[model samples]
Target: MKIYKKGSLYLTEGGEMRDDLINIYKDAPAIFETIREEIGKVVVGQKAVVEQILVGILAGGHILLESNPGLGKTLLVKTIASTTGLHFSRIQCTPDLMPADITGTTLIEEVEGSKHFRFEEGPIFANIVLADEINRASPRTQSAMLEAMQEKQVTVGKNTYRLEEPFFVLATQNPIEMEGTFPLPEAQLDRFLLKVFIDYPSPEEEYQIMERYTGHAEPKVERVITRRELLSLQQLVRDVPISDDLKRAAIKAVVSSRSWEGVEYGASPRASIGLILASKARALLSGRDYVDRADLEVMARPIFRHRIILTFDSERRGVTTDQVISEIMKAI
Candidate 1:
């Protein structure tokens, strides 16, 4: 692990960070570990899922979680929010859900003696938000989040309100093939930094989960980091260094996807950006300041899965996005 203290993290002029900032980077592991440990108490399994959530949050990006029901996806998100001590909110996406429902609206209210319209903040104002079953919502309703998710601000009426730092939207959706689900458009999917998939737990882990929940109450989660520390940690994660070699490799991985056989479309430049940022976050979590090949390889799938659109022939041949991504990974 490389520990940076009161020195430039990069050779660039903007790398001249303060001493306290240096201290935060050095102490990041402890903070991350403590949060992980706290999350472990309530979450029975899905270690990888938990790590992905932390990576997305630390990277200062949004995450789209995909999994079947009863996989502890919601539990994992709640546990992460509790341990990190961030304000949490949730919206159950449905066909009737409107854009204002998530972004809030101005309504007439009595103040003292007079009644006037005031803007009330919505659930999107929180540091961590869970959009459960997001695919159930109509596309128009879903489009309401475009501004807040990308620009970190919402334009309601003539006013634009900025979201607080460390704001993250953790949305979940079932398989698109399922009924009553509106497939997220490519444009909307592109906004998410990564798409994380959760699988079923092992028999042993399942038994433990049953024993813990059915037999005993899960332990209370303790806050490991405050909002201020979280903001500093996100900054430190962005500061992690990457050599030019790895930077090109990340770009190559994305560009190759566009023309790869058995695929119709490829990831955009944003995918490249997500790969670098996510890889850096993974490295920071591992207590290393320098990103390695393994970091990029591990993050490849999540970075590319949702961004790529498979062709009809590829679909007929039973070629999945992960399968295509694996080929790209091998090629890279």
Candidate 2:
């Protein structure tokens, strides 16, 4: 499939070009389903949240999870890591957490009668990093992770270290408790590709959860796809055809969020880029050849939710950022 850059958007030829893209997308569901099946072995319910995380991974972006305690946010990340056969690391963010604690630290070590600085990598170096209760950490410590998330590398004492490919940071926050919690700054929030809001499970799902845990037999989860396969899938998503019309619509929708009434700040250009990237992944998951308006609409909530800032007036009226974004989609 040949992609041509026209103006600020990418377009592909209509007939054969579309078919090739569709074929690649069709193959994704099989792999995605296999991963879902593996995750199901350990995780009882919350299929929607799991799907969102998969989308983020395929899109090669990070995720921010907002949910109440004991909703299995950490378990979901762990399950994903285990199912994908990736190295998983968990960091418990706390008030006393320091930048060096999450990133690496440089220590002096003597070698051959000479002292040399050795950099010890932290938990962020793993393939999958689950940052539990991220809001509890101090701002400085939180800021330290921003560079790693965006650039996929960490610089310690003038030495830079690149992270392994297929890196994913699934950070969770407790929404019910805000006391002594340092909210993530807007800049850091923008780095995340999606903000998934996990709600309570259904009655049937709750029963399944109870039954699954009550038994002494532990559910075994097998790896569905290797790390190399995931990396290849990410490349495929980038190569997926995106029509000019759909790209424009994505940009317009992101622009609308910023200028929309009840919003304090609109979505940035980065939000627009994120929407396009995420929409491509969503399209692939849905077995589509190219991104469409529907794909953009389906992905709008998670991509723009954390990017848009609601005004005080909107907050007073109980108007949420999602509502504002929904309105923009309708208007567009």
Candidate 3:
């Protein structure tokens, strides 16, 4: 249950949390509420999805968003980037996209009659990169993003370039569009901390969406938090305490997935790690000083859904990954 990062967390001589750290934890809800209020300016609903995205941000993890087309997935990511004041970039993935197109390429340049190679950074260099319709990209192009997403760095040649801090890849994919699309490899999918499913909005929410977009003046959202503040929040999220019992619960859910009847392949150790981290972030978002069972219950599906593979019988019976995860949690 012990977690360590490069920077130290503040604690007193008795090993209790410092007053300043406690203050930050107490203020977390208000700060996140302001962020949601800004995002609500444009997005009409999907509060749960928004919270999960915030969890990914606070956990310093990448996210994969899946939904049918025209569900505002791209708009949501854009709004989050805008609200957080993070440098944003978008890559419209397509079959023709090359590996160099994503990770950048070395280009020859001449200066003062001397020619040399210079690395040109790609769209992946931003703080928050939106890989729109990621499944549409060629496998080669998708693979190019693995290093940047996992290692937070890119290698063009013998030299490697470090991406800016707080880097995240918020990728989107259409669930129904299978034609002419390359499915992401298991390795690539494993890299995503959470796979969020965006459902259709309610009629009331849709009506409000129409009202907002049909108007002559579009709704405007202002940045609520800066990069430095967000970085600090990320650090604080890691320091949020989780009891051994809850940590064991998170691990048990992951382990149960391996022997779960419907699951063919279980989640990796990364899932256990991601589940714990996501729960800590969720607790902080709820303005709690410690992780709760509710946090683990709520985050289980997103953490394990993409990591496990369903059995043929389960697929034929129309059982989904979420259902399997739910059973695992209940058993644990």
**CA RMSD per model (angstroms):** 2.2, 4.5, 3.4
Clashing pairs in 3: none
lDDT of 2 by residue, 60-152 (tens): 999999999998898788878888899999999999999999888999999999999888899999999999999999999999999899999
lDDT scores for all predictions? 0.87, 0.85, 0.89
Off by over 4 Å in 3: 1-26
Candidate 1 minimal-lDDT segment of 10 residues: 4-13
Stronger candidate by lDDT (1 vs 2)? 1
Off-target runs (Cα >4 Å) in candidate 2 are 1-27, 111-114
Worst 10 residues of 2 by lDDT: 14-23
lDDT of 1 by residue, 1-332 (tens): 34433444523223556566667776888988888788889887788888888899989999999987878778888888998888999999999999999999999999999999899998889889999999999999899988999999999999999998889999998764578889899999999998999998999998988888886555789888889888877777777789899999999999999999988899999999999999999999999968999999989998899999999999998889999898898887
Per-residue lDDT tens digits for candidate 3, residues 1-332, read 12223246646322545445555555668889999999999999999999999999999999999999899999999999999999999999999998888888889999999999988888998999999999999988898999999899999889999999999999999989699999998899999999999999999999999999999999989998889778868878777788899888888888888888878899999999999899989988887877889999999989999999998999999998988888889988
TM-score of each: 0.95, 0.91, 0.94
Instruction: Quote the positional error of residue 138 for candidate 1 in Å.
Output: 0.8
Clashes of 3: 0
